[model samples]
Target: MKMISIGQLAKRTGASVRALRHYEQSGLLDAIRQDNGYRLFDESAVQFVERIRVLLRNGFTLDEIRPVASMLAPQPPDLRTVCADVIALYHDKLDELDQRIAALMEIRASAGARLAFLEEQRRRGGP
Candidate 1:
């Protein structure tokens, strides 16, 4: 089995050492320490880190990402159950995003209306 030191893992994965440490602290990634107390990561951890990056980029909070992140580990989940859970999570996130978008659109409309009113007042020579 090929093993990489934490620094090499960080360099290859474009992740900061601190970030990796955080992941380790969060139980998202595991590192074995050498006799010298330096951390070593398995090669497979690189792929796991990449998966974490994907989950986080897709707007998953750390808490939300943690469960999904655990899935990337070697432990196996029942495929159908896992798929259903993921679908549910996606639906929930979609609803939240929809609500946020609606609120933003409402704010934009209000801003536009205010702008129009100001423009009209300016044209009428109102201070």
Candidate 2:
């Protein structure tokens, strides 16, 4: 029945206290209340916060995360559906990254070509 305050949680989780508060506001985390109006979180909350960090890093939108997090509630499992959704999301993000990379490569090539042409023009005397 051990619990920790917000500062302690932040120290343990390596997340800012502001971020923890935001997570609570986002319904991604919950805290118990002490009689003095202090917020207390169980040790398990550390793991939950880490999971949230992982999801965010993986490009999971907050809204999309809601449905996935629903699986972690005190209920029956829905892992298969969550896995499928995560796979699709990953594919979409990867495709977006690929397109971005291609655009950057094209821009770089164009810049290189322009520089080469300018160098050649300069070599031919200012024209």
Candidate 3:
């Protein structure tokens, strides 16, 4: 079990050093400090960071990821309840996305109508 420095972890995880530090600060990761004051991470950090990245890409905010991260920790308790809660969160996110898509669609239709109306006026020489 070779412990690696933060830089190596960042390279392996494709996450910036600053982001790694931020994750540590956010309690999403843990690092061991050497006597020389260098931060070392376990190899398992690679997968943990990947999970974090996936969650972020999937629209989960850092704050929202905290609990999910906890659920993935070693020796997690019964996950049935957690799964239910996560399902609810996902549903809420889906609802919000639906609303946003509808609003954008409405805006697109209005803009298209305005453009068509302007084109008709131009064709009619009505300014």
Candidate number achieving the greatest lDDT relative to the actual structure: 3
Candidate 3 structure quality by residue, lDDT tens digits, 1-127:
7788999999987899999999999999999988998999887788788878877887888888787686554332454345665677678778988999999999999999999999999999998
**Of candidates 3 and 2, the better by lDDT:** 3
Q: For candidate 2, which ten residues in a row score worst on lDDT?
A: 72-81
lDDT against the true structure, per candidate, is 0.82, 0.78, 0.83
TM-score of every model versus the real structure: 0.82, 0.71, 0.80
For candidate 2, write residues 3-34 as lDDT tens digits. Answer: 99999999987889998888888888899988
- Candidate 1, residues 1-127: lDDT per residue as tens digits? 7889888989988899999999899988899988999998888899889877776777767677776665665443455235565666678888988999999999999999999999999999998
Rank list by lDDT: 3, 1, 2
Residue 108, model 3: Cα distance from true site in angstroms: 1.0
Pairs that collide in candidate 3 are none
* Candidate 3 deviant stretches above 4 angstroms: 74-82
Candidate 2 lDDT score at position 102? 100
